[model samples]
Target: MAILDYANPTRFLRLTQIVLPWLTAACLAAFAVGLYMTFFVSPEDYQQGQTVKIMYIHVPAAWLCMMTYSIMAISSLGTLVWKHPLADVSAKAAAPIGAAFTLIALITGSLWGRPMWGTYWEWDARMTSVLVLLIMYLGLIALWRTMEDPIRAGKAAAVLTLVGAINLPIIKFSVEWWNTLHQPASVMRMDGPTIDTSMLVPLFVMAGAATLLFFVLHLQAMRNEILRRRVRAMRLKAAAGSRAARMAPPSSPLSSPMSGTPGAAE
Candidate 1:
């Protein structure tokens, strides 16, 4: 019910206005703490040495990349069924952010891989699926930009998002399903994480920071998009009013005191 109600632009804007500052503060604080712990407190990897520090950035960014896509997919579904205005806003705002995180994940993964695996990249299952996910984000963004109509673009993007969602499972299970250079699950396994405590804290902290940052950024983008829609509506209305005024016939007017003639202007 609240979700439907917040589909109203003004309502969403007002809510974000109240929440955004706090979220931004939390993101900054978490990021600072996460970075400090990652560099200072965490032990260097026995095998990869200091290069393993890349995991702090790489793992969190990877999580965010997937989380953002999931958000886009859910928002698209909302747009399709609930017809929520902010759903489209959410999807549009999320695409580029997700892509950026995916890029970070790829770059950092490569850095880590070069040191540990002795190669910059491998056409492994996990790597390939992650690459495909990034491409999907790019495609969604391209579609949105190429289309003229906002509603139509949103619908098209939504469809693309849904289609791309199939890759998420593939990316998730790729390590388990095939032999790969990419490491198997660490934090997610039912038997508990394989990572030691010193490294784990930084990873979790970084994940929290990334999650906070995403919401803060998402809210800001949505607010800007809503304002854009408002401006467009106002411009369209003004244009319609000008056209109507031009189409209207000239009319006789009452005499003004300043003018000593019939049909004088005020």
Candidate 2:
């Protein structure tokens, strides 16, 4: 299948080179339009006023925070179950990006919360779980770096990623399961979004833009990872070759003048 072809690093690199330009352009265009809508078109919330606009950035970052990890989790499965060649590269590259998004979500949430909740932070379920998600992201990044061998690192990180996945559901349903300062599903609901269309349109537009941004970033990161791995492999091969050359036994030469004894007459 076409997807399987990408397991080959060469093919993947080619695809990335072709796709990245388009993705970048789309991402930039979406962000431009989304920002304009967020600041100008969407009216201020009656309840939160201008502070509510923070939702545009906060919500999208949070979505990416979780979405990036979800991608990693799937990649982990690819590494362990399917043994796809680039699976580890994909997972490794995504960790830092996910962490960045998580950090953004946390900071923005705190800023938004200070005005609404009268506190910068609380130990409530939703907040705490998100904090846990951030910590998990940090831990995974550390795990990858701590291991020298990519193959081994990937396998180990894959297990940890899968284990950490338990938190995803917890973060999502934390509000419903327990008391929390954070509000429950206003936009993502079974009955459809509760927010007014005016605001919803902007939110969805921003979400689309953010999603595009993630792909642009994700693909770029994957390319870098692939190149890094190639460099590493080359170095290893060079080191091995040098070591072999050093250890090889020296060659011996037969005397051309063995002759002296047999041909005495000169």
Candidate 3:
């Protein structure tokens, strides 16, 4: 019941309007502080040297890429199972943002890899699985675009998203599961993060910033989707009204004359 209440487009729009400004401010402030700490405060790694700084951007983008997909998968469940009104919009909105984050992660990883590994890329397990994730995001976006009806598109996309979610665990554990150039998990390990506190703090701040930015972008996208649907409905209604008017039979001039002079004509 509560979910349905919030699913109302009017209520969702009202809530987004109230929250968007604060969300934007928080995202901006977090990025500012995070960037400052990343470049200025964090020290160079003993081995990686200055090149380690790229992790600040690359790691967060990688995290958000998976996070955005997780969000979409959950929203897809809502769309398919619960039939929530905003579920499709949320899933659709997240696809492009996820794809962008995936792209950023890939590019930054390649840049970091070039100097360290002597090459821009390797066909390693981690890299390959992440590439698949990116493809899944693009495919979901394409599915949404190709369908004319939102409901049909939502259901189709939802099924595809859920099916594709098998890649999340693969992406997360690829390094451990297979031999790869990619390092095993450091920050999220059971051994409790080999990274220094100074570097970890900035990394977390940037991750927060990235997450907030995703929310802001997703909200704006859903709002736009709602407006688009409204415009489409109004246009359809107007077209239907025009068609009904065109189909109605016109009154005959002969009928009017016959009524006025019925007795004389008889």
Candidate 1's residue-wise lDDT over 71-134, tens digit each? Answer: 9999999989888778998999999999999999898887777766678986555566778888
Instruction: Write model 3 residue lDDT over 163-251, tens digit each, in one string.
Output: 88865676658644664344444221212278889889999999999999999999999999988888887787687656655766434
The ten-residue window of minimal lDDT in model 1 covers 183-192
RMSD of each: 8.0, 10.0, 9.2
C-alpha TM-scores of all predictions:
0.83, 0.84, 0.84
lDDT by residue for model 2 (138-220), tens: 99999999999998999999999998886568665865466534544332121236578888888888888989988898889
The full ranking of all candidates by lDDT, starting with the best, is 3, 2, 1
Task: Report the lDDT of model 3 for residue 145.
Answer: 94
Cα-based lDDT for every prediction:
0.82, 0.82, 0.83
**Candidate 1 runs further than 4 Å off:** 1-7, 170-192, 249-266
**Top candidate (lDDT):** 3
Evaluate model 2: give its lDDT: 0.82
Alpha-carbon RMSD, candidate 1: 8.0
Clashes of 3: 0
